[model samples]
Target: MADPILVFDLDDTLYLERNFALSGYQVVGAWMQARYGVTDFAQRCTKRFETGAYTGIFNHVLRDLGLMDSPDLITRLVELYRNHPPNITLEPDALRFLSLPRYKGKRGLITDGPPRTQANKIAALGIKDQLDFVVRTGEWGAGFSKPHPRAFGYLEQAFQAHPEQMVYVADNAAKDFVTPNARGWGTVQIVRPLGIYKTPPADRAHAPAATITSLDDLTRCLTQF
Candidate 1:
């Protein structure tokens, strides 16, 4: 039988977002403000996304911020997001983790975001060839939300494995770990120390299957599995 598959979250899990020039929401907000003269539009743009209606969440942000008064502006903002310089950095130990011999498993990336921007980051990092699957939200006809079953389904099908035959490592405890744990996939929390915004004290209580402080520590953490 083939070894179990390994599913990973793209941003912050595989390649750390050391310092993003602009977060997804920030990018949308900046476009709204600069293109439409609306101030404080970032908050509104983020609010719509948080509410689970992401069908052109950017387009809506533009309309609410007054940039959509012209259709051409909408097209330009879309183009900008696609071509924006990636601000994410590869975690120092990413190559080591990828090189581990014991991890003889099909590898896949399961991330949620605007398809174009996320694809750019994946391509720029040059790891797409290593990935057996690339599951994106808008591009795959799936719901644009994390912790959604559909997202998991796309991954399982791509990797050709059952839920129990995969281990998913991600950074966020709430969005990344908890639901997958509930879904019966092995879950590891990447415990890279975040400067002021540390992992919530609550995640310590909940406890992931393994806690890895760095990408290099991943092999050690998975020894028992």
Candidate 2:
């Protein structure tokens, strides 16, 4: 028997996404304007993330925020993200799954990010050393983004596994699960919203290979898989 691939989404999947208060680029724009008298920060954020380029992101944000666009902007922006910190909370089930002695296959992270920022968050979560691989859409240098099969395909190539053999877990149904399912990967939806609230009316939610309301539900469900 061969090992199946386990491609996990870090933000909304393994960790509770809503906990971090991650809004779109528009929110980042508002934050920058309020902090540094910079208007139109959102357009820069949107372009940087959409194109998978970190250099432009930091430099643009810093310049618009009234900081000099020197080489130090990268360092400054990094410090800001690290020290400011987002709302990061991991599910108990995620900890259990990652801490298990063996997952019976090549396990990896298929997350979307500009790289350094995501790496910082991953390290803060203390899961950096436990995984077999970490695939960042921008870090790969191919200019790709998640929910895109190309990003997922990179892990498939590295693990030498088929999409159907993999189990993908995430919170966004339309962006995370639907695309993977179309590509034949098993999908699990994590529904733990902030304050443990269940949004989007549970009854009408789209069906996944498995549905879990809490981290504790992972063990039992994975056992069946």
Candidate 3:
């Protein structure tokens, strides 16, 4: 039987996913400047993305910059941004957390997003080999996205582990905890200052079993298992 599972969330949970976004912006910015001679295009694009105004962001950026006449700009930028390979490093806390001698072999991961995009990140972070089971919910279809339970259910089945025997660590309170918490799994949120989601979610079901400011806090709790 598989040892008890320790699942993780990718993106901002394990590494600063903003780093990935920033990398894309750098590429997009340079591509724009070279092709259109736009000054400060990259910085403006980065600011827009960081503000969470992503819908039609490329078109909006162009329009704001008086490049409104550009044809197919949004589609081209979207494709470029999504395809750009990200240069990222695991946070030192993540390295320290994973370096724990006890938790090494039990690790697994569950993440949501475009399969190829997310796959690039996992490969970039070099965490694939460390995982015993992996599930990218987008590969499973829209119905399986987090808080849907099916993705969590998939992990349980993959490892032949039950909810009580699994521990899930993710940073997003908006969607990460609902299914695991409802199923009786151990859920912990790493609310690091660097994490993207900082405010407490309004829904009570989204609350985790425990909350920690860092990954190192998990060592003491996991030893209980």
Candidate 4:
């Protein structure tokens, strides 16, 4: 069989997304401190994030500091967070996995998020040249994100690959595998220690073809494809 075209999800699959979050929080925090004189804002944001406050985190921090959680304020903070230059690096295991001899020249990346935010991450990781191509779903609109088939379809056309000759490695089960699985692309889930999604998919359709706790097991999992 021909070597499969290996595509990867960018966030937790290639690097710890928490690091990007923390980095963004720092940028937001610093901005808050400079604009509103709120010292330790970044630290407080990190604390809330660590405590599982995934949504409206900035609002919570503002309320905790006795500031008004105004819509305008929250929007600004969010914009700042998403647009800031990110500080991140590839996971050691992911780096090694990409450097493998067999997989060289066959790599691609597909990620979902705001285009600017995802592009910033791609640039910070310095991974553009490492892969054959990248698909930022946001560029196609929110409706085209994972579970939507459009991005995966783009990959299929770009590689001129049959579904059996492609594999998508990602972290999120809820949306990552559904379209790929239905399209007959081999799908593997890489569950990093700090990966956000922990629960298994409730149904087979959303589940990955295989799951690995680390990228080191990626090749072994690929053999099944």
Candidate 5:
């Protein structure tokens, strides 16, 4: 088979999503401290997140600090978290994998997040020059996120390749593989040691064709299909 057009997911697949969350927490915390004199907001927020509080973390943190979790306040904090310049880096294996000679000019990225946030991450990772193209689902609209197939379709048109000639490497099995699998695209899940989604797919429909612990093993995984 021809060398497949390699597309990747941005968050946990290329870098630990935890790092982004931590970085954003720091940003939000710093803002809170400066504005409301809450010096421990960042630490408190981080603690809540580490304890698996994935939703309404800000609300919990505010309640802890005896502050009202008002809609305006939550919105402001969220905007601050998503718009800040994130301090993050690519995973070591991903860094090495992207630099490999065989994949040059064959790489692309499809990521979902607030457009500003995703752009900030892509810039911080310094991967813009390394990829042939990047598709940020936010640019299209919230409804176009993974499992929606809009971003994947964009890649197909951009590469002018058959679905079978493309592969999507991502972390979240819950929503990452369904559309790609149905479209005949090869899908591989990269289960990073610190990745957020670790549970087995509920059914085969959501499962990746192959699973690897790191991008370092991506080449070998691709050979199977």
Candidate 6:
């Protein structure tokens, strides 16, 4: 077999997405302090997270608070979260997976989000040195976002791999696996406990070739092909 070309999703697969969310919350808290002189925002965030209310933190804590209902304030909050230097660390399983001998494949990353936001994540995880190619869908515009197949096609070309030789490992089932499945490329979804997306809901119409809980399981999963 030749070296497989694998493209991974950034946010929840390479590292815990919640960690980035936490860091962004801190940034939002600081912005709130500076602009509105409000305190305890972080504490409130902690409470929300503890209760498993992870998504929409900004919408509830900031926008609903009436202190930041303006569009400019929302943009500034987004800028702050996206630009803030994060304390993210690569998932041990992810690091180990990258080093494993069985995955002797061309590795790349394809993420869909604001370019700077995703780039900050790449730097924070310290995996820029690990990836052979990267294509952020938002950089090209929303038309190329995941499930659109353009970014996946871009990765296949960048790695010089045919669709059959290309594999995509990602977390989100709603869109992550759609394009790869439709394009006849292999698709894997790694869902860890810390991932933002819980159960893939088994919708076979979008099922992965293998649904793993650890990146380390990838070697075994790839063999089935």
Residues 1-225, candidate 4: write the lDDT tens digits. Answer: 667789999989999989999999999988998999988999999998898667889988899999999999999999999999899999999889877877643878899999999999999998898899899999987588878888889989998888888999999998899899999999999988888777788799999999888899988788888
Evaluate model 6: give its lDDT: 0.81
Better of 4 and 6 by lDDT: 4
lDDT-wise, the better of 1 and 3 is 3
105, model 2: CA deviation in Å? 3.3
Ranking by lDDT: 5, 4, 6, 3, 1, 2
* TM-scores of the models, in the order given: 0.67, 0.63, 0.90, 0.96, 0.97, 0.90
Regions of model 6 farther than 4 Å from truth:
49-56, 63-68, 199-202
Q: What lDDT is obtained when candidate 1 is compared to the true structure?
A: 0.68
TM-score pick, better of 1 and 4: 4
Winning candidate number (lDDT): 5
TM-score winner between 2 and 6, please give it.
Answer: 6
RMSD of each: 6.5, 8.3, 2.4, 1.1, 1.1, 2.1
Assess each prediction's global lDDT (C-alpha) against the native. Answer: 0.68, 0.65, 0.80, 0.90, 0.91, 0.81
How would you encode candidate 3's per-residue C-alpha lDDT over 78-161 as one tens digit per residue? Answer: 778887778898987887877767664477888988888888888888888778888888887777788788878877888777
- Which of candidates 2 and 5 is the stronger one according to lDDT? 5
C-alpha RMSD between model 1 and the true structure: 6.5
Candidate 5: list runs displaced more than 4 Å. none
Q: Which residue pairs of candidate 1 clash?
A: none
Better of 3 and 4 by lDDT: 4
Residue 62's C-alpha lDDT in candidate 3? 84
List candidate 3 stretches off by more than 4 Å.
Answer: 1-4, 50-56, 69-71, 223-225
lDDT by residue for model 2 over 1-225, one digit each (tens)? 444566678875777543443333445556667867778766666555545453457676666667786766466545554344454656677888777775566678877776776776687688877778887786766557755678777777777777777777766655666666667777787776543223342332234678887656665566545
- Cα error of candidate 2 at position 48, Å: 24
